[model samples]
Target: MLHLRVIAPAELRNPILNVLQREPGVTHIVLHPNAAVEPAGDEITADIAREAANDVVERLKSLDVQNLGAITLEVLDTVLSSAAYHAEDAADGDAADAVVWDELVARTRDESQLNVTFLLFLCIACLLAAVGVLTDSPVTVVGAMVVGPEFGPLAALAVALVRRRMSLARRASAALLIGFPVAMAVTAGATLGFEALGWVELTSTRELHGVDFIFQVGPFSFVVALLAGAAGMLSLVSAKSAALVGVFISVTTVPAAGFAVVAATMGDWDIAAQSVAQLAVNLVGITIAGVLVLAVYRRLQTAKESGGRRSAGV
Candidate 1:
């Protein structure tokens, strides 16, 4: 369920009331006429069934409530009403499966910010992966994967592509194009700095078989990335954020890219080339999977809507 608070002008209060009155899933309606001092309008509040929220929100938006006044919606944790139950039954689709495109675009736009904190986290994550590769530590590599912020931009790109938002797509692309190079460069610099400080030594060598985890690229790597990409986007869109950590752990982008930079710096071109290939494979797999999964979900949703229309004799 969702609690919606709308502030609209007095002139349109009647139309707004009509929308609420017409929606069977909307209840606990409260009207405060000319109650807003700053906005100088009526304040209306209602509890809308979660399943029916999308339709109700769309109707309200069609009236330009967002632009003229304001519309605030928040999730309702608890609703104890038979009316709410019937309202849920009255809804055309399940809210849990709902994809609010506007909400998604806003979320991705925010996540695509290429700020100093983003770079800082990226560098730290890359450095951790570099160290993990050098020491052949899967745990360290996993830690780097957890810290890396690259998934946000990747997911943003996927969302933009699905929504046909070119500006958002460019923002996500810039983040990735600028982020990876910067992070990889810092990883190399960190290696040099560590060597200078007598922290560890790395030399061009052929005995890097132990770190095969970083350099080994195969079809399975792509398959895992594809699954992780779908899971990551689903977790984000469905508000199941806890599942995101698992997605992070499942992808190889950070570790492979980090290893590529460090290996190249140490003159290990064979290992560097392999790591780069692994990185490329994982990134492409994730992207293609994300877009396809989102598209499929949308198609299924459309089919469900069509079925509902038929059921309603529409």
Candidate 2:
């Protein structure tokens, strides 16, 4: 279930209240007249079934409620009311399968920004992965993967494409296009520093057995990327953070970028090229899978809503 808090202008209060009252998936409605100070309107709150959230939010948005006043939606972790149960039962589909697109857009928009925090995390993850590459430690590589923030922009790009949000697409694109190169450049400098410090010789033909997979681009690499991408998108839609962490650890994007920069800095052109290829494959696979998954979810949602309307003879 979701909790909706709305500040409605005086002129639209009745309409908004009526919309909520008429919806079978809404309950616990409260109206506080003249409660809003800044917006100077009524404060209305309601608990709504997750399955009906998109429809309810869309109707509210169509009334320009968000522009005129404000609308806030929050997930309800626990709703013990019998009315809440009835509301959920009245909805057309399972709550877990519902996709609240407005929420998603808001989330991805925030995550996709090319801010300092994003760059810092990416650079740190790449540097850690570089360390992993030098030591041939899969554990360190996995840790680096878990630390990488690249997935947000990638997922944001996928969402933007599916939703046709051009501005979002551009932001996400800028994050990836700029973030990776910047992170690689930083890690490459760190690699050179390590070489100077006699930490590890990058020029030697030392075979990295455990971490060599970071550069071995093959069918399995693409396949793993596709699976990870699908899982990542699923985790996002479902709000499963644990699953998202697993998705993070399942791909080699960060490690490949790290290794590519290190190899290039050391003048290992052949290994650098292979690492670059692996990075490209992973990025492409994850993006393709994410786009497909989101598209299918949108299609399924439309079909479900349409079927519900038909069943109600609307």
Candidate 3:
């Protein structure tokens, strides 16, 4: 449900009230006319009288109410109504609007300076994967998989494509293109140093065998990537964020890249090529799947909106 508070001139109050009253899911309506404000009339206080505020926002926007001094809408979930309302109030919409675009850009930034925590997390993931390869430990491999941060750009790319935001897509792609290669190169260099120090062994591990999981790519690899990509986008759009962590673990992007680095360090050209191929397969698969899922989801949402409008005879 949504709660809406509208501060408008007393003359426009009736029209706005009429519009709000007809909106579906609106449980209450309150009017505050010519509320107290500073000389600029930029600040005015209004009381919320609606139970479902989201519905009111949609309606008010549709009505195009003139002389609307200020409009504020709040969403309320039945199970967490108080928390939801408080969250909305805390955001203040002004701050939210100011930061949303910047946040999106930051999320899609290419070659931006990463914070210490993020850099540490990435290094830790790569190091864990390196250890997993050397020790032939699938558990460690899975742990590394869960730590990878590749999914953020992937999901952002999906959102950009679905929204037809080319700049966003380009930024996201650039981040992935740059971040992955850099990570792989760093891992490769680390592996070489480890070997020189006699601290790591690349051979004698069954997991590193050419046939065990060494880049034996097929149609299935593409299919897995595609499915994982779709699931990743779903996890992002849905309220269930914890599911996204699992999705990251399920995809083999980090593992494949880690394996490629190990293979390259060992001078195993065949295994290296195969691992590279597997990495390519997964990247392409996820990108395609993400785009398709976003397209389908948008279409469904549009259809629902159209149906509602027709039902409302608007």
Listed per candidate, the RMSD to the true structure in angstroms reads: 2.2, 1.1, 7.4
lDDT rank, highest first? 2, 1, 3
Q: Who wins the lDDT comparison?
A: 2
lDDT of 1 by residue, 135-224 (tens): 777889899999999888888899889989999989988988899999999898888898899877887535656556767888899999
Per-candidate TM-score against the hidden true structure: 0.90, 0.98, 0.70
The CA-based lDDT of model 3 is what? 0.62
Higher-ranked by lDDT: 1 or 3: 1
Best-performing candidate as measured by TM-score: 2
In terms of TM-score, which candidate is stronger, 1 or 3? 1
* Better structure of 2 and 3 per TM-score: 2
Model 2 clash tally, residue pairs: 0
Q: Model 1, stretches more than 4 Å misplaced?
A: 37-40
In candidate 3, what are the lDDT values of residues 104-216, reduced to their tens digit? 33444442224444455566677677777777777887898899877777767776776677877776676677777777777878888888899976663335543336367
> Counting only residues 3 or more apart in sequence or on different chains, how many pairs clash (N, Cα, C under 3 Å) in candidate 3?
4
Relative to the true structure, how large is the alpha-carbon lDDT of every model?
0.85, 0.92, 0.62
Order the numbered candidates by TM-score, best leading. Answer: 2, 1, 3
Q: Residue-wise lDDT of candidate 2 within 45-107, one digit each (tens)?
A: 999998999999999999999999999999899889999999999988888888899899899
Tell me which residue pairs clash in candidate 3: 2-52, 2-53, 2-54, 3-53
Which of candidates 1 and 2 is the stronger one according to TM-score?
A: 2
Candidate 2's error at 39, in angstroms? 2.0
